[model samples]
Target: MNYLVKINAVKTTNELEDAWSNEDYKALLARFEYPDAAQLKPAELKEYLFLAISDFEPHEAAAILLDYKCSDQLVDGQIDNLSHEMLRTKTFENYSEIDLHHDLFNINQLLYSAYNGKFPLGTVNLVEMEIKGDDNVEELTKETALKALSYGLSENNLINRLLSDQIEGHKAFPEAEGIVWELQHKGDDVYTLTISEKWLTKTEITNPEYECTVVPFEEHQEAN
Candidate 1:
């Protein structure tokens, strides 16, 4: 399931538009290599902002901000600013990591770039797992397909050992309907890659902002 994070508490008309109106984000589409990566249409700019800002549970995000430990920056257990907002987001259920990867891939497709260690795990999943999962993959670039295949990730997963954290390198996951190649990366790439395994099984919501029970993927579909 994917997270449906919503801003909580009282709502104001103005609210926060920083993410909604940010223009600088458009420049970031370059990594994906767009025809006009240097310039973005207004609609495109605002759309990407929502994704960047919308990610993360409010409390989980807040904890990383200044004065979170002391609660100085928070007002009444909440921060209004999106960056460090204490009670900014309340997560609903049924958001798929697969969907998140797909959505983010759609966004990234607008840009021009190559995937590497620096790419977000979401982006990596886009180039790696999601594309392969497609029933009809008409065409995939050699470089792109090679990079993804080398990672040992299968569209499906196997569980030879339950709850075993041992590093098995690349092995087939039984749950995977067919061949499975495990994904492993070093350095900053780990942030997104490791999350695939470590993330709360979509069952564990240790983070206060995320809820255990959730919604389905279709209900919260955003405009494409």
Candidate 2:
């Protein structure tokens, strides 16, 4: 669990300064909209920016931090489905976990939240060990274990399947568990692979088709 906190602090300070220079912060509040940078506590502002920084150009990330709204609704810590202000209200101070899988920020947001005790931006974790008859020591191992429930899919089984024939030669990612067939039909050969990061599993999203979005573990963080 490598933690990165300094960068977030710097970004937050920058946003606060921007809001101070412009009346945008006051105007946003007067409209009953999300608070602007200056209105945000530096810690909260940093978490928000961190959550929204994935797949964004450096300048774009900066712009978003300066202009977006920050509110509790926008505080899921994921950048997707949020206006600038909505994103600003996210602070790791309140949330126990941060999800950063898809709503935005990808892995970077997760990394940021991990340091601050917020959940990852877009992931959920299951207690594989506490399923049934498991010992405490074994349960500890199971914490890192992955299971498909129905097919008795374990992390090893999942990875082996991908290695054998499932993913078509795409290498298994390091922090990722294994692809789980979330939905499967009798006739259709398609299944949704439940991808996950180190400590959290992403919530299943309906893709409406057979396509799988496999982002390389390295590229899964922030796009260069």
Candidate 3:
């Protein structure tokens, strides 16, 4: 019998200093109400952004963060006081997760509290995964795993699906488990798959879990 085995995945957090490069700066300035926002230099841009985001009420600031694709990310382990202070308070209050290593830093997972009512930005994307009941785990790929993690952590996914049985309790607090997956793609994009000894199995969100371990895995591979 191939009952699924499980391993530990850590919830690792990191900050990307250049997540938004000079290329992004132009688009960022374009959306702002500031007429000269696009013309601002480094120093001027920082001043303008800081002013625009820093002063609004918590809810408004959250909108700007998403709408503007704000540069800041929430992180742990000795983060500077100034940076934390500058980030919108609602993000932390409403809560979101951080994807440490990827092509682009996925900022907020839109776990926005409904206290402010829903908006267009409330929706997020989901990555698919196929769970099989066997030792033949070749179906799972690194790319697929990464996509699953992102979708699982997303507000829409969480609200829709209950992860308590998969990990410790989706984004298990205090006692976090590590998730690891790898895949090698050939001509047709099929994966040469390798994952942690324990793989993930998806569960329905409607089920109320009594004591499920919905663990949020930490990705060790960084984007090259």
Candidate 4:
């Protein structure tokens, strides 16, 4: 039986709750001919429940959990995090290899300049580019290459492809003015890129008033 179809067919929360209570859900799962169904643990069953309700493909959901090395005791928060990652995966599903390579070229160029030519080109893989501003650092998988590509273009991310191209020779010197970029080697093909503002020049601004009026309560009441 189609796993998603079967699970989704349970139309009501009450039905699902009752099925679980009566072990009817086990019978439903048994019909799917899942490998080693009898040996499945509570955590695995909970993951299956999460997958059934999620928007991702069953195989994709399973793969994501496996890649993250989720423990036997899956929780709601973990499922939520997985869902977010899956959304990023979907967003970049159509990202082409050519575009990816182009971005990679810029990234490698920046890295080479940052390391003073010591870092070899074409060594950084898609998985090595870390996403910025995440609460927890996630080790991206090959399937999440598109997510990396998207994050790489942002100013907050490690790659900062656009910023790298704008700087002369793609080199970020310590004494550079304006925004300063820094690269740190985090070992075993991992690198962290960060940026900070320095000697920022402020621009004076004036707000021009548009055609507008703030009416008093008495005038507003009279108009109404």
Q: What is the full ranking by TM-score, best candidate first?
A: 3, 2, 1, 4
Taking the tens digit of each residue's C-alpha lDDT, what string does model 1 give over 50-128?
3443353433323332122224423543323322321222111112223232222222222112221122222122111
Please report, as a residue range, the 10-residue window in candidate 2 with the lowest summed lDDT.
Answer: 5-14
Candidate 2 C-alpha lDDT tens digits along 14-103: 011121223533342333234455566645644444444444543344335433433333444444433232234333212223232222
- lDDT per model vs. reference: 0.27, 0.30, 0.33, 0.29
Task: Name the lDDT of candidate 3.
Answer: 0.33
Candidate that would win on TM-score = 3
Candidate 2 runs further than 4 Å off: 1-129, 142-144, 147-150, 153-160, 163-224
Error of 1 at 16 (Å): 7.4
lDDT of 2: 0.30
Compute the lDDT of residue 108 as modeled in candidate 2: 27
Score every model by TM-score.
0.18, 0.23, 0.30, 0.17
RMSD of each: 19.2, 18.0, 15.3, 23.7
Alpha carbon lDDT at 96, candidate 4: 29
Off by over 4 Å in 4: 1-33, 36-68, 72-75, 84-224
Q: Cα miss at 212, model 3 (Å)?
A: 23
